[model samples]
Target chain A: MSTGPYNYSYIFKYIIIGDMGVGKSCLLHQFTEKKFMADCPHTIGVEFGTRIIEVSGQKIKLQIWDTAGQERFRAVTRSYYRGAAGALMVYDITRRSTYNHLSSWLTDTRNLTNPSTVIFLIGNKCDLEGQRDVTYEEASKFAEENGLLFVEASAKTGDNVEEAFLETAKKIYQSIQDGRLDLNAAESGVQHKPSQPGRNNLSNDQQANKDNCAC
Target chain B: MACLWSNSNEVLIQIPLTEEIDNVTFYQISVKVGEIKWNVKHRYSEFYNLHNQLITDHGVSKDILPSKKVIGNKSEPFIENRRKALEKYVQKIFIFLRQTMPKIFVDFLDFHLYDIYFLLQDLSLLCFTKGDLILSSSRVYSFKPIELYAINEFLKSPAPNFTNSSKQLDLGPILDLCSQLDAFIIHGCYNDYLKSNIILNKLPIDLSPFKIQKGLYLSNVSLDMVTSLGNARETVTTLEVVFSNVKRISDILQCDILHKNTLEESQKWKVLETLDLSNNNLMDIDESINLAKNLKHLILDNNYISTVSDLTQLPNLENLSIENNLITVCNDLHRKIGNIKTLNLSLNNIVTGKGFYKLYSLETLNLSSNKITNIEELECLGRLPCLEYLVLNGNNVSSSIDYRVKVLEFFGERAADIYLDNEKPSEAELDKVSILSALRIVKEGKTPDLSMNGSS
Candidate 1:
């Protein structure tokens, strides 16, 4: 048997959604690019990023879609909701409107994506503790009430940011291992790779294609 | 000039000029005359005449030969006869005007220019009415100045003739188009046609509302749409069916709207996990839970469900809440949900007894707002190796249960070690007489040696 970093074994599709100014784009940037973009313009339709991460000794590639936050743009961005393996339901800790709109956002996430999609509720901008509009206790209780995995994270400070993405990936990876998420299904948003020779060359070709197209 | 009259059979008369009038003016006057005569001098003195011509001439009528014309040709005998009649009536009026007034007739040529101008104006107004009729009937009028002027006048005038000019824009077609495109971004109030019709039926199965992207909000949807979505099994993952009066999930199970191969090709529904079907009028919970196999968390709060038997077989369920139901007992609940970590049975009528004894792995239990009146039954839960936080607020135990101190004393050491409520018992609170008395009983009696054995 031959092995060279074991070409990606699992591919997880993630979707980030929330109200405007909730820093969904920032959280995505911090997780995929590992750097904070302070002056990043708001998303117009949907932005995509991919990164290969190792979890449980398995190389998993996360395909994340960052969507526009405007209500009218939901028509254009909603198509990205299909085939998601993980969904980050983000809310701004400093804005109660963003917190209060969680149920509406949760309803959307529930109605659109597949059943295996891992929903992680993230209270973003946790560094703005002074202007906190939603108490951690209350948000945590809400997360419990809604049956969502929750955490208070800051993209600017990188606190719990990595944990949120990694936790979603771990949950998806676990689902694949458990056979709950079938890799052969069309909309499962997962692709399973069998251990084989010359798989790296095939992946490099795919990476090159990915570099050519901005999905 | 002379007056001419037509008889019933074939009599006719014509006017004749007395003097050889050179360059004479011809005046045409139309009058509505009857047996009762009204004064006409004041209205038409400038053109009317009574003392001009005194001559009459009659000619024998000639029958013309019929020409060989096409059957549909207008230049035939009948049309020619009607035209001759019209010319005779005009000539008679002109002759009568010349006969009535000699001086007025002499000056008529000078002021005759004014009559021709007014006659052309009347003809133009008549043409405008005809144009209006054509435009309204055919709707093919060119954008000419005259047509545009008439349309503007019709729009501005508050006449009832042009009713319904302010037609409402129909939204049914737009909604139908959006549904055909598989777009589910519904917002704002559409027209009545779109509001009542269920366009979800026409949408493709793959892009139906059940297959909509996650994190979408759909308000004011009908029961038909909800049922259509519920019937969509493998494609729909995370769904929050709210606001509508959905009484039974079985209504959704009957639609068979999902692709048959969706579940077999299980990768199609890989992303769906959480489903919130709360605040409905559901009395049974079996059908909704059976849709998604990978469902992890289920919230059935604020329903009329009296039993939890339907939720027993969900293997991956971690967080389950049947709070505010009418459940009176927790029979076989622990065995059914051996893997569940959080269970909320609050706001029910459960009595503190052996019903809650076997939840061995429960981490947090909320039994608040129940009629539990004693803490003795809580000793059964002490056997649960993982019980960490327990909310007994709003129950009758705080007031009627005198053994609260005794129950806390029995598990106080373990409870404090687990950091229950994030605090250790204070010295004064632990030294209370009620708690000390229970501790003395445990020390004197065999109490099963219930101390930490480092086995959990």
Candidate 2:
């Protein structure tokens, strides 16, 4: 989202999914392009964006996929849930129905991704306090009971948008450091580039030879 | 620079009023694009067909538009609600499709006369009127830059500011301009290709009755005879004879009401370059293709041609597209289309690359979506010296982990310049290819190139 990810150590795939018209695309556009899309139409299928963010001194590229059409096109969005390292499940704070639909969205996220996937709950439209329908207390409690990381943010005012994305990346990077995520697993949704330039000559050759011999 | 704002699409729908014609009630919906506004007196069924065409063609959701009513459709409340729904539908579709507005959507709004597509119709019509001044024997045919550049920029000089530019063309007469300009093309115009620079923007009907010299593009509409004794028949360059339901090429030309001498013993389309015969029922390439002795490009997509036959006679044919056919064999295809540079055999039933070695001039080859299953079946492609772009996308071998690297190995180190599936080799892919190359050298009982380091 912040640009110049042509050089990065690892790529973490993220999917920002929520009900239709819940400002999911606005949140992503605010994070990536650093602008408020004033009269943006909700995306049809899937819109993709990327940003290079430094996590624990490592340049980790976050490839985010923002999607639309929940019930109208669930079949297309379901395929994106897989191979996602982080899932930012969003809901509009002004609309209680969007908040109440969080359980079904969380269920799809949990059932599709691996157990190590970091899911963060986001209560969007926090700037609209007078129109807020679902209180922050109940949403935080719902996140606690469901064992999910949660935040109350505003895509319109760009509040806590960075925290919601970076905190999830930090947790995913923490899992890699703790060795909970097997790097060799293809479905891990984390690609760690080995011997990234100017560091290894002998080791990279040995690694390629080892892979070739196995093949 | 004086004021700043976002460039957003603003859609306004005036309150629709009910008008009755004979006994049927209709909605006169008026919508505005930018500063230009127009009214459409369309029935709900007509709106349904237009919006449905846009959705089906452009992949927009069909649920945005309002549904028809079985009861109380003419009631004031129902009319008001449907008007709001249509407004929202137009707003949403305009936001999503403003950049690449589909033809159906533009036609629905009658914006074609104001948008860039209108330039093509205007330019063609203007050129035809100018061509009337010179005789058919005149060799000089060129337009002054002022004639083309200044008039073409009629929309831009005032710049119908897509946001607020108020320049407008009369919306009513331009509605039927397609059929009217099509009449000009069919109004016995010779060198039709040269007059319009060979690009006609989607003519809707058949032009079989008249003399079309350079290009004859007919689609979906059937024809009794493509018989024309035009003076420019000897110099006709492009001919697209698709979906006319003719089995033999002679069926297109063997009948003529005006001139029997044009077909009598032989009809030589001497310099014909392009012949498109798509969505027809031609079972095989006809021997009548020898008629276009200098033909360069032939498109036979969506036909029932089961074999690669009768094409060897068109010696100058360089490009051949036989996609979506029942061609199950290409064992001797190189003998037929050997000199062709680019070949599209996608969506066919062919299973092997046998006899492809003789296709030494081949450059770009699309064998995707076919029955090619394994690597050994395509081993003969490595022998071609000029194979640069190879597309094997829907084949079974593509699912393998190192499928890209294995395919690039066909070109050895020259794989660096080769493109597979329209993608340039990534750094990781090139790394894998180098390892495969080293392994191949080792398997041949020779010492591997140890001098080649990983960084290199």
Candidate 3:
């Protein structure tokens, strides 16, 4: 394993979901790679990315799954929602259809994910001011009514992209600290890395299993 | 300045019609990025896969490309259509490659071996001399690679200009020059690909093999071992592991996952204080709720609870949300939630305020979207000393007899805390309301008949 010198104590699993063409992949790319990918092709089954982020002085690795937003792909994508700690429900600000489909997306998320999953509604493509079809206030009100954290972010400009991902991580971390999220639950989407470095030199198979357990 | 520099944004991708065997046209594409030209001969299906992969990996919008067809897809006309689409697709891909400058795409190009071999085959064909294949000579070679043949075809085509700054070029020497440049560039590209493969094999962090697992047992702990291993271990940071679409405890607790008296329940619900029994088929809270000793917030929204009788047993309950239920009356509800700070009973059948008079510590209450038609219900709510905020929107009582002023006068000094229809009475609005109340008291010697106009 190429883990850096400092040991990470936890790994958070996240899933990005929305209707097709809402920039879920772009948002993931922006958060993971810190660059806006303008012409990102549609996600097929699922795409994955990881970044080690710090929250409350803790270095947390975010394992994000970017799922295909196409409706037919939902059968394949639905399975990925099982252990997500956070779900970024995105909608394109330029397209009302994406926003209108939020409830359906939310239903899937709420139905499939654990109750403690932190769902953050993202109004993407905020950079396209002229083409905006959804207002921030309306989306925020929708978020408030649905009990979701809301933010207007532009993946192209990288505006609030960092905050959206980081905020979800922070909320999940808070839940862990508050003990709302059970670390040992099979589907809690949280893994507590036991702080024992002495037993780190185990056989390769055991070491691999230990690492997989931390995902 | 950025707009003026568009002319310098050079892209040189070679598309050659490599074959026409059995009427299935194949294009050998050599896409040049910097000094390395990645060459690949692909049929339409491979192009489709490439396009789809590009879309998935990069999130590129597919709006500009032609829609795919399934009927008669293998016919010559359809193949020709796909070939045209492929040309546009490659151009767009190059455009994206130029703009994003992603290292992964470059690696992806190098990783696919057939493209490199195709380019090498074209180079060796041009080399003519057998010994020169092994010769590490940097000298310029002869005929331009077959990949550039498509560029000449494009130049000869009668299509409209793809770019604004279009210029005509002499094809003869350009082809020669491109061919000569291909020898050294092709050699260098192959070397880099081989060298990187060696380095990649040597590295301890190749995680592609063990990363993907289909079963939940395998996926539960699988890390993006690639990124995690590469990340520097600075401070032992805390990680939040979220499994996707795991059955929530609400369903799991009521059904299969956790059995009673298992090690699972104690651990899972150890610090679980709030339990959401909302939108379930629950008729009422049973004795099972008493098990949650530390439970404070209990949400039973959208259920079938008819009364607040079952809630009295929750020893430490503070916030209760039982909205969208069949609750018709709340007679002495305070006896059950006397110390509760917040209560939400919206979207219910609550018709009277008889149960709320004694909730002295309750600060916030939501009674919206109910059948409350009796203005007298405000008196029961007004008596609660700690009641700071209240919502009664969508109730029949709200549309009766100056509802805001009447409610404000009833709340007295706490009128400023009243939230009617989500609108809190401002200081000025409340002051006016109180003055009107004082005038009415002085003029009439009693409160106005604030009852519903006719019914109830």
Using TM-score, give the best candidate's number.
2
i-RMS, each model, one decimal:
22.8, 19.8, 28.7
Worst 10 residues of 2 chain B by lDDT: B182-191
Q: List the residue pairs that clash in candidate 2.
A: A1-A50, A1-A51, B156-B159, B161-B165
- List DockQ for all candidates: 0.02, 0.01, 0.01
Which of 2 and 3 is ahead in TM-score? 2
Off by over 4 Å in 3: A1-215, B1-268, B426-428, B436-456
DockQ of 1: 0.02
**Which ranges of candidate 1 are over 4 A from the true structure?**
A1-215, B1-211, B215-220, B225-227, B230-232, B253-271, B401-407, B410-412, B417-444, B447-451, B454-456
Rank order (by DockQ, best first): 1, 3, 2
Which residue runs does candidate 2 get wrong by more than 4 Å? A1-215, B1-209, B225-232, B253-265, B446-456
Q: On residues B1-456, what C-alpha lDDT tens digit does candidate 2 reach at each position?
A: 000011234555453666778766666656554543556566677778977887777788888789878888778777778877776777678777765555566666644443343443344554455444433334223322222222334424443333222223333232222222211212111222221221222222223322344655555433442224333346558766666676865554443324433433347777678878788887887666666766779888998888877465555667889999998887655445534668999999878876465564577889998887787777678655557888999987778778888888766555666789999788788888778877788889898543221111
The whole-model lDDT of each prediction reads 0.55, 0.65, 0.61
Candidate 1's TM-score reads 0.36
The true-structure Cα RMSD of candidate 2 reads: 31.6
For candidate 3, write residues A121-198 as lDDT tens digits. 999999899988899889999999999999999999999999999999999988877668878886787776555355
Docking quality class, candidate 3: incorrect
